[model samples]
Target chain A: MYELTKVIKDYHRGREVVHALAGVDLDITDGEWLAIQGPTGHGKSTLLQMLGGLDRPTSGSVVLEGKDLAGLRESEITAIRANAIGFIFQTFNLIPTLSAQENVEAALVPLGVSTADRRAMAASALEGVGLGDRLRHLPSQLSGGQQQRVAIARALVKEPMVLLADEPTGNLDEETRDDLMALLEDLWRELRLTMVIVTHDSAVARRAQRIAVMRAGKLAIKQDTRPAPAA
Target chain B: MFATYLRRELRRRSRQVVLIALGLALGVGLVITVTAASTGVKNAQAAVLHSLYGVGTDITVTQAPAAGTGGPGGFGFGLNRGTRTRPAPGTKFTSDRLNPGQLAPLADSAVTKIARLNGVAAATGSLTLTDVSISGTIPSFGGSAGASGGSASGGTPGSGGRGFITPNVFGVAGVNLTQGAIGPLSSGKITAGRTFTSADASANVAVVDANYAAQHKLKVGSTVAIGGSTGKSTSFTVIGLVSTASGSGSDVYIPLLRAQQLSGLTGKVNTIYVAAASATEIGGVSKQISTVLPKATVTTASSLAGQVTGSLASAASLANSLGRWLAIAVLVAAFALAVLLTISAVSRRVREFGTLKALGWRSRRVVGQVMGESLLVGLIGGIVGIGLGLVGASLVNAFTQPLTAAVGPTTGSATPGGSRVFGGAGQFGGSPGAGPGSAFRRLASSQTVTVHLTADVTATVIIAAVLLAILGGLIAGGFGSWRAARLRPAAALAKIA
Candidate 1:
């Protein structure tokens, strides 16, 4: 579903240029659950942003379905993200003013979805995550586990081709984290989406079919735990 | 989508929106109020000018006097002597004017010629009797009814003896016969009897000012002997009585052709009041008239109003010019303040904007949202400001009196009791008994001069103000939108601050 060819990303901080991603090459099969795991500053988040089209690579290219993302215009990249990719932030990143349902519907806004259709899709997505009863509750009113469930519903509402999660369970308790991981796995299987989760936890990485470990702006290791399916 | 985003944003940050709106409103209000007040003053000045030069006469043409003409030994040195000996043009006299011949400009033929010119609605000639002297029984100051010619010109009267009061006479051709052309005769000033008309032009008729008639114990149909510049006395029947207010020049009105004949300067006129076909054509007509009479100095309503030589002129200038600029300064400050408020409000939402970007919202969409909210704020502020401005203008108008000045046809020096043809009340702020403060506050408490406000909030002005407000808001939001567009979604999501 996605491929990165020698992807390099540099950040300008005052008088210094920090390379967040350097010469990264990776590939993911269709409908596979992949996890990129690394320490705090090892470019895990940067690679996920480039793959989701939230940020562009400084050099090289990221390709989805044979189309190079680096060669497209900014608007074209945003269109691809709106239609094919969804992101779940570590902080849950729900607009504090919006209710849970509204937060879910927000993902469909850039896709030019009708209000009624968006509402219907958002309701179904929330029901799938067992948050249908908490549709009108704001993020501040929701529990940590429930807020993470809302974020998952928001990511699922769009029915994107790829679901990207950046440290999804970072702010949750151990029990809530485990529940959210199991919910994510269920969504991955039911929606048949290519899921890419960037995290520092080995336990979260172990649930994925394949794990790529990044260290010092480089892909250090790749481990496959699932058997290959028949063609 | 933009509307929904805007609605939520405004609802969430309504306090900031109100703050910015109020700032803009204050600026727009001040400008509107001041501008309206200034317009009111200009309207009042136009009214005064209309009364001063006769209604409908937008321009006046006067011939400049010959160089080296008026001095101690020149023309009009001490013409108050009421002498019978006509002063020569170049006479080395102490105080005598160049008799009628030197002062007259347009001929009877010129009046007809200029009237035929394009853009000229009407043209009329006037002959002013500047040095005419009349020897009549001047009722002492209090209407005691004294004998005629009891005291000669410049002579001191004996105890209890009444002195002579020389009344100047004005002869006009095309004046509004019923109302008359000048003060004490123009509408509302006539107390009794009726004014003369064009039909009485050839009749030996006269309209005696109420003030002059009261002093002389004269009435309608009474005959008065008017001494001419050629030292001849002619008897004229007082056809009507006219009561004049202070500063109204002259006390008698007669026919222009008779005045010309009386001054022995037949076929000549000293002043010409020209009316253009329309207000917009005044300029072109003035220029055309000037070309026709190159030696004449032409004055227009706008040009006369623009002069700030006296207290009244200064007040008008304040209302017309200084006040407008002051309002603009306030408006600019208000816009700047609004911009700052909007920038602060928008900047605080940087994280939310980043979230939107991550959700695939384009940069233009973000810009549109910011701009939409700003325009809404500006619109609300503009409406509030307009209301405040109108109220302010009304309050100012209520407290301030319409400024007035003494203006006349020629813009020339006024002569006491002389035929001040086309002279309105208080010319040059030196009306016979005017005080020093007369220039600024010339109207009496009993009199009311309506100052109509010109700041009526025209559609064009409203549109322009709204456009300016929108532009200001866009400029302020531009900074925030740029910052939002440059935001890195990954960094923004991780920001805990």
Candidate 2:
């Protein structure tokens, strides 16, 4: 579970200091599907990065399972990400030189995993994403949807406690987007991975267990789906 | 892992490695060949000189002309002890006179050994003859002597242009020869009948140089008669002939006492040969001889060895010159290789380096990686160069004639010394280094004579080559570090191709 409490993220360029995230606060229980909806520059991605411990908040607290993410050193934060945080970027940042399976294996190589175990786990993760036959295909050979699926498989390979995705369907066609949405819904039900999706899509927002709306670098509202549906 | 990496690098860069090897091989091979050829000259010189002149005959007490009597060319020996000093040119009685009895005092000192210096197979001192007209006829015919001192005009072929026997101002070796007791000639090089026996000293015999024998058309057992101022001297039979064609002319060699007796230069044979205990003892022998014969300077075998290897001296004189050129060439190659590797590394890594730094990879790690790459290249290059040089040295050695002019016809003997020209697989051997007969003799003490690509020379060259490679590696690594340290982490990582 991650609790973000009034975190401000600032960026300074030359003489200007812009507040990307200003006093945002939110909390979500474990195993829940959460969606953050915001326009560009509204601190949606910054909030996700803070929650994932990949970026530090300029002020205030990003607490994950009672650990203060902002207080950790860079290496400690890296270790936390590698162990418990999984990121699904909008662009599917897979290493181009490696095949889907090899890309998954590269991350594990640095972790000192045995080759046999790495391949078996990677294969299983690919199968979970219905990409068992495309394990050997390189990112260049994959379509946008398939490459995103490979990224999903990579994110799932380590079995992290949470998956954080930024604009997951932002680059896909309408048909592939619907299929991916269904797959994610099914995975969410079957594996029960606590995941947060940051997107502008009202449709994707509608599918989540909870919705958090951000505006002007602050979270303006959060609605619980079960109670809000009755309203 | 390193070996595997090396094998991969070599395989991947096979063409480049081969090119490097060939270049290095050619350079190494030439060094070996030239060094060997110079060594040959030394060996040939040593062998010939030793056989012609005994190794330890100290102080060749030739009569020095009174100061400032030099003609053009300085007569090449600083003075002409050969020409008459007291009388007219070619006078019958103005040959040098010295007390051979001066040798007696030497026998009492550390100079326990002594031998009268002479250049012939045998000598006879025959009952102390006052004078010997011992002449060979011009034959009233048209045959030339060995042509040693002959003029281009042919001298009218024994005509008044000139008609005379090859002259002889003799010495005392005839006693050794007539008695058949000739010493080792480069260890058992006998090309004629037996040397004379001790009884032959009483047998009234003579032995001569092969050059003289051939010149006069004389053969073994031939009787040679001569007239002397004392009386008609004994007619002696030719018993043996020395087997060197080195210098020309007919000079009859007689036994030691006989030659002294014949020249009336008896009690005046100022020179004697004494073998040093060993090559290491040459200096000591020289010192011992100096002490014994205080009036004369004792020349060591080293000095004479130098005299032998004239060609080797010339070659070695080129050492600094050739070494400097080789150093320049090697340095240029190393610099070019360093620049190539460093430039390539920098060019290829511009974007990657930026990415790594942005990803939180530290500056020190980036520097370390770059240096590692450079070190890898240098190590590979050095090993390749050495292998090529070794092969090249072998090829060169095969074609080389290993002798030196300085190493021939030495006049002094070190112990365990066998004198011959530096023609026999010549090597720099023993202590005191058998000096050259000329200026290099002074350098002998400081000069370490390297072998001619024998086991010894091979070792020296290898050490030098490896050291050069280490130097190259340091350059590569240091330059890489310098280059890497100057890069801006943000800009370096930001470049995208």
Task: Tell me each candidate's TM-score.
Answer: 0.79, 0.51
**Per-residue lDDT of model 2, residues B54-108, tens digit only:** 4333222111112222111101011232343222223322112111110211121
- Every candidate's lDDT: 0.66, 0.51
Interface RMSD, prediction 1: 2.6
Off by over 4 Å in 1: B64-105, B116-121, B129-200, B203-255, B258-265, B277-294, B308-312, B320-322, B406-464, B486-497
Docking class of 1: medium
Among incorrect, acceptable, medium and high, the docking class of model 2 is: incorrect
lDDT of 1 at B185: 36
Q: Which of the numbered candidates is closest to the native, going by highest lDDT?
A: 1
Across B150-191, the per-residue lDDT of candidate 1 in tens digits comes to 222212222233333333333222232432443223432567
What DockQ, between 0 and 1, does each candidate earn? 0.52, 0.13
Error of 1 at A203 (Å): 2.9
